[model samples]
Target: MGVQTNPCLVVLAAYSLILIQANITPVLAHVINQTESPATAAPQAPPPVAPVAPVRSAMQPLQATDLLTADKPCSHGLERQMPYFGMGAPGPSGSAGIPGLPGAGGAQGARGERGDRGEPGLSGFPGSKGDKGDIGAVGPQGLVGLEGLNGTKGVKGEPGRDYTPPSMSAFHVGQSSNLQVTSGSQIISFNAQYINIGDDMSQHTGVFTCRIPGLYYFTYTFRAYSHGSYGLNIDLLVNNVVKSQIYMTAMSKHLMQTQSTIVTLRVGDDVWLKANANTYINGDDEMNVFSGYLINAI
Candidate 1:
């Protein structure tokens, strides 16, 4: 079996070497005196020791004879020296030292994580009112509204002063003279009375005088035959002013014509029919007539 080498022998050998270098060799001197002659006895030479191979080799066995009892071989290599003892046991740890000055500041650390959000703040006070602006342009007109309801009926009006029973102040007169010749531009004095309500007409003068202040409608018809190229022409006058007229050419036989007008008249206003120069009217069995009637009163 191989020998188990001891580790304590290595520590003891290192301790002995440290003491010898520091010149603390009193114990070493005593050990040498036990194996050598006194220094004053005589200058004696010591015996030599030959180098020996290490005993740790597998083939070699450790023996007591390898360690010399008398003298350590100083001429031998230090590595050849034998390990005799273990290092002294470690001393107790010393007391804590005084504190030192603070060290220099280190490099800046990494950024930290983000913090949580904060709560909302209270609402602020309301602001003051602003000044008024200029007026805007007018907008487009709106659509028309629906029609309104009919009004109430009015009271019945009183009869007019010149009005009589069958009709109002009105007249229808005719002339049946088969051929009435015109001496000049004169009034046609009609002689036949078909209707003369209120007697507001004059058969002699051929004029109707108004007795009411109102609008009146007048119409007349004449049956006639043209004699020559000077066609028949007639006039209906209101107060000496021509209000209506008609003309006929000589190219036809007996025929008929009509003319009508509306006018606003006051009391004493005259309305009449007159034949112009060179005009003839037929009787047509008394069908030639002139008429007038009040339509509205002021």
Candidate 2:
């Protein structure tokens, strides 16, 4: 009675409210369980995200038109070209290299031409003479060579002077003095002379002296007149020595004898006649003569 509602309408309204409560209650219960038991909940997959691009400066992009066109101002468009790098100057000369090993010897060269001849040298001095050698043995005689022509005759020589022979002579006696008959020897004195050349005869000594040495000839003649029986002997003496003798025996008559001889006389020699003792001589000038002469000079 309060308004006395229709019954059907009221049932319908309650039913509709019940349906809304059923759906709202499940949703609320699910949220409550997730909050209470997170470990037990299934993980959810995240959504897909886009890739990030590289960071870029705030510059404009380059283009072929900006590079080709020189007059255009492209300050932030073209990238600044890097500066070209050139090779540097050659480095300082390296240090001197080490000395290398010696090379092989070279081949022999060709021979040179011959030189000109030299001048002649001066002569040497002569050497001294050597000593004489010893005499060698005598060799056999060699054959004689042919004779040469004869020479002309020479002039004649002068004639030599002639030589004269020594001359001496004694001839006759001038005086008679010896007239005795004695027993001993005595000299007969022919007291005179005729030719006594060279004055070699002496009248006083009754001797003939030789002036020159020579060969001489002597002659003596004696005449003895004796009264009684007596022997008369005469000797020719040379230098007081008897060289020759003459002997005669007279009974009464006068006896005459002549004797001649040759004798070699030296200088200063003497010749004289001596009578024997016991003989008498009549000293007569004509009979008793003693003479001598040089035949040749010695």
Choose the strongest candidate by lDDT: 1
List where candidate 1 sits over 4 angstroms from the true fold.
1-167, 179-183
Query: RMSD, each candidate, Å?
Result: 17.8, 41.2
lDDT of 1 at 11: 44
Worst 10 residues of 1 by lDDT: 68-77
TM-scores, all candidates, are 0.44, 0.44
lDDT of each: 0.72, 0.70
Candidate 2, 119-231: lDDT as tens digits: 98898899999999999999999999899899999899899789875465544454465566567777766667788788888866678889879888988887776667666
Q: Write the per-residue lDDT of candidate 1 for residues 1-298, one digit (tens) a residue.
A: 9987554455457656764653545545555765686655554444333233333433343344443222342333332344332345678999999999999999999999999988988888988988999999999999999999999999999886985644378888888775444457767888788888778899778899998789999998887775665456788888899999977766467778899999999889999888877677776536788888889876
Cα error, residue 49 of model 1, in Å, equals 48
Clashes of 2: 6
Report the alpha-carbon TM-score of model 2 versus the true structure. Answer: 0.44
